[model samples]
Target chain A: MSELGFLFAGYAVVWVALGGYIIAVGRRQSTLRREIARLEREFRTGE
Target chain B: MTTVSPGSTAQPDATAAVADGGAGGGVTTAAAAPLPEPGRTLWLDILGVVAILSVLVALYGAIIWAPTEAVMGHVQRIFYFHMPSAWVALGPAFTIVFICSIVYLVKKDLRYDRIAGASAELGVLFTTITLLTGPLWAKPIWGAYWTWDPRLTTTLVLWFIYVAYLMLRSSITEGHSRARLSAVFGIVGWIDVPIVFMSIRWWRTIHPTLVTGEGMNLDSSMEAVLMLSLAAITLLYVYLLIVRVRQLDMGSRLDRLRQLSHLR
Candidate 1:
């Protein structure tokens, strides 16, 4: 492939890696928050 | 801007993951505090906005503002993104891991562990970019996609060491043991960074020298774009770190609450 081809490819790899990391973190955060809320409500009523 | 939603924290969906399914299923006094919403951080909004803008400006500077290189033609343009990814990986990312690892070891605080883990993950992400882009630039210029040059080899090793760090964090079920063990490895893993930096100077290698000082020469425009790109990447790293660290903090707290509820 041409040099420009390589250049564009590199940018694509960068964006994909960074974007994926962000999305993964977001997913984990949402799951954790949901658990936290559920546990808190259960504790409130039990008390 | 206010970062919080000012209402009850968390959502209904995450309930399944941390449900005290085994517990008698009742709210306790310890669990009354609301969990902070991870997405609502004001700092994230501010930093995210700034990072996006900087990346846009850096993108323009890298492709349009910087003049093309005479020797390598357009391929050298990849240097703008390429070098900064390596820079962030070797510099702030690992440094944060190293610093936080030490602090975690000394203080035994889970917060530092969270920061170290987050930074290590981000470090690996950027290093993957570096590793990927290096080969792309090399293929057209060096006639091969892979080389066992000193710098490249050390960088690859550096990447693996931190990859192991992440694996350790995820695989260990207990939080304290995970933090303790990973802290040790995190410190050890960071030892390779300086070696990676000095490899080109220490051995006969194909990798370019550091872009500034020490008898190296870079065009004014090239240097400017590189700096801008580095700044943009740094901002992005900070934003990511903020998001990741906050999430980890919340996760750790939830784990504590789980333990507390289990005790009743």
Candidate 2:
């Protein structure tokens, strides 16, 4: 690969890694929110 | 007559205990309420804005503003991002993990453990970036993607150490035990850092050494660009650390709630 190609690959690696991590965290946030809501609902129903 | 007793606070003590205890729900939801989510303050807003701005400026400074090297030419540009990512990863991310791990071991506070774990996660991520970018930069320059050079090998060792730290945390089922065991690894694993830094000086290595030492002088513009990239990436690390730590804290709380519900 050319020098420019290497440069682009380096830049792309940083972004794709960062983006994937952010998405994973976001998904975890949503899952936690749902879990909290479920717990609250269960507590409320006295079941 | 008021339904609530005169001595009762807005939320009942037992209910508050349930929230605090994060487990045991025998009294049920009527006896307690979920804590209100905190409002987003101005600081986080400012941080988010700064994160976006720094990243953009860093990219521009790295790509366009920094002059191409006379010898290495266009490929030298990769050094800007590559070095900064490695700087943030080894310096702030791993150091935070090491310190917080010790604190957790001493204080036995889950918060410290959570913070340590979160930092460890980011450490692994950024190290992975460094490892990836290093090879990408090296391939065109060094003519090979992988080598057993001291810096490269030690860095790869450091990466595995933290990766193992994370995997150990994940494999455990109990909380305190997980924290206890991983804290030990976190503390011990960080000893590799100085070794990684000194490898170039300490051993015969193909990896380039001393960005501004011996004969390889850096231009002022290039140094300034490198500094800017470091500052930007460090800020990015702080921002991500805050976010990940908060997420871990909430995750532990959810775990407690699940346990309590299970008991019911």
Candidate 3:
């Protein structure tokens, strides 16, 4: 592979990994929010 | 009402006291409510967009505009972003330590503790990127992806210390005790930062010390691109910090609202 090709490929891989991480963090945030909401509902109903 | 304490005094009549105190004192007391600031959020969003754009432009400049190094060839391109990532990591790590210290010394507020937690989380993210990218770049230049040199070893230790900080946080139940304990750990962990930086400098190492007091000598174009990339990544760190802090704040507010509603 040409030098430029190798460089571009490395950049692409790093960015792809970064994108995946962002998505994972977003998912975790959503799940945490849902869990809290569910707990709130339960506390209210029990009371 | 009865005044039980020695220094305490009771109003002759509660109703009269309220009427007289308010009219005479001109003090309109209300609940301690926080006001919403829309402009700040808008500015943060704008800054986030600008930071993202700057990073993109800087990346283009690094990859395409700057001439490839004769020795390392294309792999040298990674050094621009790599150094910037390391710089960005320092930002959040220092932020975590500084805020944790303030929180511990001042009001001992858990809000700042939470902020420290968020900062530490983001710090880990950036530090991990630095660690990973360094290896990827080094594998081509240094002939080995891993090294036991002072710079690499100290950084690894620094990474583990912060990771331990997070583990310490999780091990404790969430409360004032947890906050205080974590604050102490955070402060202690930060002492390693200077040690890590100094070890590489004080002793000889294979890692190139590019930006020490001796000065960073580079082509004008190379210097410009490096500065731009550093600025872009620093802005990105700020943007990420704001977002993460907001998310934590929202989560806390939702928790409090739920508790209050449960009481009702």
Candidate 4:
């Protein structure tokens, strides 16, 4: 690959890694929030 | 430490509780599972915006404003993001893990453990970036994608050490036990960071040393862009660390609540 190609690939790697991590974190957070809310509602109903 | 036990008295003002499964069943005290503050959410939102904007500015500064190097040409631009990722990984991210691990051991507090774990995850992420970017830069300049140079080898080892630290954390099930064991691992795993930093200085290597007892090698413009990139990446790391730690803390609380509520 040319030097410019390497540079583009390098930047792409950084962005994809960072973006993928953020998305994974957001997904996990959403799932956890849903579960917590559901359990909370369940407890309230039992009360 | 938010241990769940049967027959304990439930607080009347508990955030969640079941009434009929025995008086105290399915009740967890607020103190045992404290939630993140509402104001902190707003603070995180503002921080997220600032971090994103700073990163964009740094990206522009690196690609456009920074002068091209006479020797390495345009590819040298990779160093702006590449070095900063290494710095954040070795400098702040792993260092935070080392400090938090020590604090967790001393205080036996799970909060510090969660922070340590979160920092370790980010440390691994940034290190992975450094490892990947370094090789991409190396392929064109060094004529090969990798070498057995001390700096590169030590960095690879450092990456594995923290990766193993994370794997160790995930392998265990019990909370305090996992924290205790991983805290020890995190502390010992930190021994590699200094070695990675000093590898180039201590041994003959092809990797360029940007900083020395004298000063950095870059011209003023390159230095400015590098510094901006460093600040941008560091801010991004901090923002991610806060958000990840908050989520991990909430996950821990949810686990305790699940145990209290007898949820599957």
Give the lDDT ranking, best first.
4, 1, 2, 3
Residue-wise C-alpha lDDT for candidate 1, range B1-264, written one tens digit per residue: 224422224444444433655244543544546556645767679889999899999999988888887767787777788889988998899999999999999999888988998999899999999999888877886787877766677778889889999998999966678889999988887876676657645775455632222232469988989899999999999988888888888776776566555445
Best by lDDT: 4
Chain B alone: TM-score in each candidate?
0.78, 0.78, 0.76, 0.79
The weakest ten consecutive residues by lDDT in model 3 chain B span B1-10
After TM-score superposition, the amount by which residue B225's alpha carbon in candidate 3 deviates from its true location, in angstroms, is: 1.2
Tell me each candidate's TM-score: 0.80, 0.80, 0.73, 0.82
- DockQ of predicted candidate 2: 0.49
- Candidate 4 lDDT, B1-264, residue by residue in tens: 356563353355443433333344344433245556322567789999999999999999999999888777888899999999989998889999999999988999999999999999999999999999988988887687887666667779899999999999999977788999998988877975676657644675554643221333589998999999999999999999999998988887776676576533
Task: State which candidate has the highest DockQ.
Answer: 1
| Shift of residue B213 alpha carbon in model 4, Å | 13
Candidate 1 has an lDDT of 0.79
Model 1 residue runs over 4 Å out of place are A43-47, B1-39, B192-217, B261-264
Q: Considering only chain A, what is the TM-score of each predicted structure?
A: 0.81, 0.83, 0.78, 0.84
What is the fnat value (0 to 1) for candidate 2?
A: 0.68
lDDT-wise, the better of 1 and 4 is 4
Error of 1 at B192 (Å): 4.6
- Cα RMSD of predicted structure 4: 6.7
Model 3, runs deviating above 4 Å: A1-13, A28-47, B1-40, B196-217
Choose 1 or 4, whichever is better by DockQ: 1
Clash counts for all predictions: 9, 1, 0, 0
Name the DockQ score for candidate 4.
0.48
Clashing pairs in 3: none
lDDT of 2 at B181: 94
